[model samples]
Target chain A: MKELSVKELFEKKKKDFALSVITQPRTLNNTISEAQLNRPGMALAGYLDRFSYKRVQMLGETEISYLQTFSDDALYERLKEMFEYGIPCIFITKGLSVPHQMEYLANEMNIALISSRLTTEKLALNLSQYLRNYFAPKRSLHGTLVDVFGVGILITGSSGIGKSECALDLVERGHRLIADDLVKITLQNNTLMGTPARDAGWFMEIRGVGIVDIERMFGIQAVRLRKQIEVQVELMPWRDNMDYERIGLKNNWSSIHGVNIPVIYLPVSPGKNVSVIIEVISMNHILKTFGYDAAEAYTRRLKEEIKRQSRRNR
Target chain B: MQQKEITVTNKLGLHARPSALLVKTANNFRSELHIIMDDVEVNGKSIMGVMTLAAARGSRLVLQADGVDEDYLLEEIAKLFESNFSED
Candidate 1:
């Protein structure tokens, strides 16, 4: 149900895709409902069955060449046949000359006709990527995101549980901060990508320190535009009767937008070095990825030792 | 000082999670708590110490407490063992 207007797409990709409005309808209000683009070769060939009219039609070299085969009246008829449907817009790639009949139909039918200087394949790839991102599911998380040792760790906790302070400490230790206070998470292809909220500049609000611009203070190396959320670290105040994870044998996971992200429950108390632990966690995650599991290896060693000792006693 | 002999009834015994639960429960009271299993005795309020005992199922552990809340501490810890740490 997500829709994007042609004007917005043209305005956004005008420079990057080399897109130019060839023929603007009375209003550029036509909306693109489908993220996938379509090649109108089959429909232009007089076979409209299964034609996806709800997509942005692309007139590549082949489709344009096929249309060029017809005479003026025949080409007009062919273009009018496809334009009768509710096509959002049309893009002629490789900066192909927009056929006069096609432009006339586009303007008459209120479809935005655009031209891209890039090759057909390149334009399609870039445009599809943009459309996919535009339609991705998004949510905001109340926490800080930082890249510790190339691992994206989302530090979440209660409001005053030092999430920002820990992030600041990590930033001071040369790690990169992605976002603080509010992280905008987008789910794309089952992966959660974290970015700073649109209005949330590179500033963090520490409890006693007020707002500090991290970009200006720490330089460009200390901030990231976006990062894939690799792990989630939840910091909770240490409690007497609360059971914390003492061993890393069992992995904990938290689901965000149906994607399960590994979660670590870290207990915070007086004098506990959370930033150092998070750094270790990031390195440990890397180690695990490389097939070296310290806890599991130690447990296997302990089991073998226990067996050897029992055999000796017997 | 108060002491009681309790058996570890949980199927997984004193693993990481149960040890955490035992330590958390032991910390609730204002008492110096210790768990003695065979020749190894460990502080009941310390997760690492409690895990070191490695007390398996049906192992008899002696709970010793010394302080103002020793009796109440023993009672609460006994409840955790009776419930199998809420695990099957």
Candidate 2:
């Protein structure tokens, strides 16, 4: 339910999108709540039954051509009826010529009338991309995200559990680091996309080594700007009496902002080669995704062998 | 569930373009579809999975579908294979 004011959107993307405001509404504070951009095809035809007035209206060649077919009187009446809904703004795409009546009515209603040289499809694509990023639900997670064999794994644990050290090891093994300390996660279409926190510099803090710039330290291939997190790895300090799942029959999952991601609890102990274990974990995830569950297959084969042994005994 | 085995007849096999086409086709169906190559089976509707197959020419793969429209989904996937994914 976050609102992005139209004035701010224009200020940020005007030059890049070649947007020029023909007429500004009395109030420059009009805001867009949704990322969806409406073409207003149905509304232009005077059908308001299913109309969503909150969306930003776009007028393209098709809509302009339809308006041209109407007589002056009919056009005026139609435009009047449409503007009566108090829609936010109208963007004329493809540098289309806006009819005089359209501008007059937009100004009369104090609606923002804007024009862009980009084609309708291009404009729509750009606007949708920008708005999706702006309106996406985000969270700042205290973890590290890395890509191993194309699987994005987010490593989380209590402070000073060597999360960054493990990530650094993974980078040395050719895995790509996405975010180091604070991971910025955004849910896009049921997928969690993670990036480094924007405000925090792209640096990882090693207890003794201070902050290390992952990108500069390991070249471009060692870092990714963003990646879709597919799994979570929680590093727990080894305990003497804690029970851990030795058999992989039951896999754990963690839900982040309503999206369930596969999780693995890795117990960190001295001289355990945790980095190699994390690599295997990623490879195992890939195999499981391909429907090849190693543990299940082994269990099934073992049961079949036991059956055969009993038959031989008989 | 319905399934059919088809050979990759496209000259380039299931690379980026063909994988994209296959994924697009799979997405049109409401049924959940999977592509099995050898022992590895991946979601038919995912471009990444389809590309991961790296299936070459003459690579035989199985298309499996489960849901209300499994029959229709199999038919459509089979048609795409017969047409060599329109790559000719």
Best by lDDT: 1
- List where candidate 2 sits over 4 angstroms from the true fold: A15-18, A24-29, B1-88
The whole-model C-alpha lDDT of candidate 2 against the native structure comes to 0.84
Q: Which candidate is the best by DockQ?
A: 1
Checking candidate 1 for backbone clashes, the offending pairs are none
Query: What TM-score would every model get versus the actual structure?
Result: 0.85, 0.72
Model 1 per-residue lDDT tens digits across residues B27-46: 77899998997898899988
lDDT of candidates 1 onward, in order: 0.87, 0.84
- Shift in Å, residue B20, candidate 2: 43
Count clashing residue pairs per candidate: 0, 0
For model 1, what is the alpha-carbon lDDT of residue A128? 91
Chain A accuracy as TM-score for every candidate: 0.94, 0.90
lDDT of 1 by residue, A175-198 (tens): 999999899999988899999986
Which is the leading candidate under TM-score?
1
Fnat of candidate 2: 0.00
